[model samples]
Target: MKIHEICFSPTGGTKRVSSMLSRALTDETVEVDLTAREVDFGQVELSPEEVALIAVPSYSGRVPTVAAARLAAMHGNGARAVLLCVYGNRAYEDTLVELRDKASGAGFKVIAAVAAVAEHSIARQYAAGRPDAEDEAMLRSFAARIRRKIDDGGLDEPVIPGNRPYRKAAGAGIVPKATRACVKCGLCAAKCPVGAIDAKEPARVDKKRCISCMRCVAVCPHHARRVNRLLLALVGRMLKKACSQRKACELYL
Candidate 1:
């Protein structure tokens, strides 16, 4: 069966996890990048026969605004979807339930859900280098179970955890800035999901537009993009307690 791998990964962690699951599910796959600013998401339609592995990272215990908007615009057309929410060793909180609502609203049938952990976007130390070897094995195992359920043809939506009125989305306030080492290569500008960085200047960033996804920091060739040291440290300390424990990948079918 053909599968659509729809993802809104900013720093590549969510994409990495979803890609593994999709590849395990089927060889025939199509990629739908929710981060692509040029694409009109409303025009992207899916058939009922197809399966979609829709994945996104949990930002501030919620779905990123841009990802949610892009996803809501897609025409699911009653397509079956397996929702995946990747977190940074912290809680996903309302992310999965919110995704379920969005997918259902867009006409997708939710069959299964998975919550997994990846390296923290801002605090590199937490869940560092994850969707690691063990994560891959478990995710592939989950894929097998989901495939069996799909083949059986009797599917019931799993109970996704979260509240109807989701918690307020708190900002990280960790906008990345180009350091003196920046060479104006424009790579960061081109890769920014929100178009927050200026292409010509490369150093100037629109704080209002920036979602603090850290795409620019991750993509900069010169490794010049960085958040404020004091702020990063403060955030790191705040996250340390919740992120220090290793969280296991979970599957709900």
Candidate 2:
């Protein structure tokens, strides 16, 4: 069966985890990049015979608004969906449940769910080097189990965890700024998912438009874009205990 791999991974961790699962499930697949601004997600339609691997990073314990909106616009057409929520080893909180709701609203039949750990997007120290070798093996195992269920035609929705009213989304307070080392390449501006960075003046950021997803920082060739040092340090300290222990990936079938 054809697989539609829909993912919104700002710093690459979420995509890394999803890739392992998707590769194990099927060799033939189509990728839907939820981060691309040019793609009209409303035009993305899937047949009932197809399977959708919808993956997204947990931002402040919830799915990113842009990703959710884009996903909701798609026409799932009763496709079976396997939802995956990647987090920074802290906690996915309501990410998986929220994702499942969105996918179901788009007409996808929820079949399985996964909660996986990845390196923290902002504070790199947390869950560093994750979706690592261990994560890959575990994710592939999850895929194998999911594949079996699908092949057997058992399509009941798993008991996804989370509250009906998802946790309120936090604002974009950790906007990345370009340093003096910036060379005006405008790569960050072009790659920004929300067009927050000004293309003409690369250093100028429209904070209101930015979602603090860190796409600009991750894509900058010069590595000049950075969040405020004091703020980052504070956040690191806040997440230290929660992210210290190595969290195992979870599967719900």
User: Please, what are the lDDT tens digits per residue for candidate 1 over residues 27-113?
Assistant: 999999998898999998999888899999999889999999999999999899999999999899999999999999998999999
Candidate 2, residues 173-215, lDDT tens digits: the string is: 9988889989999898888888888898988999888999998
| TM-score for candidate 2 | 0.98
TM-score of each: 0.98, 0.98
**Pairs with backbone N, CA or C atoms under 3 Å apart (clashes), candidate 1:** none
Instruction: Look at candidate 2 and give me any clashing residue pairs.
Output: none
> lDDT for each of the candidates?
0.92, 0.92
Once superposed on the true structure, which residue ranges of model 2 sit more than 4 Å away at CA? Answer: none
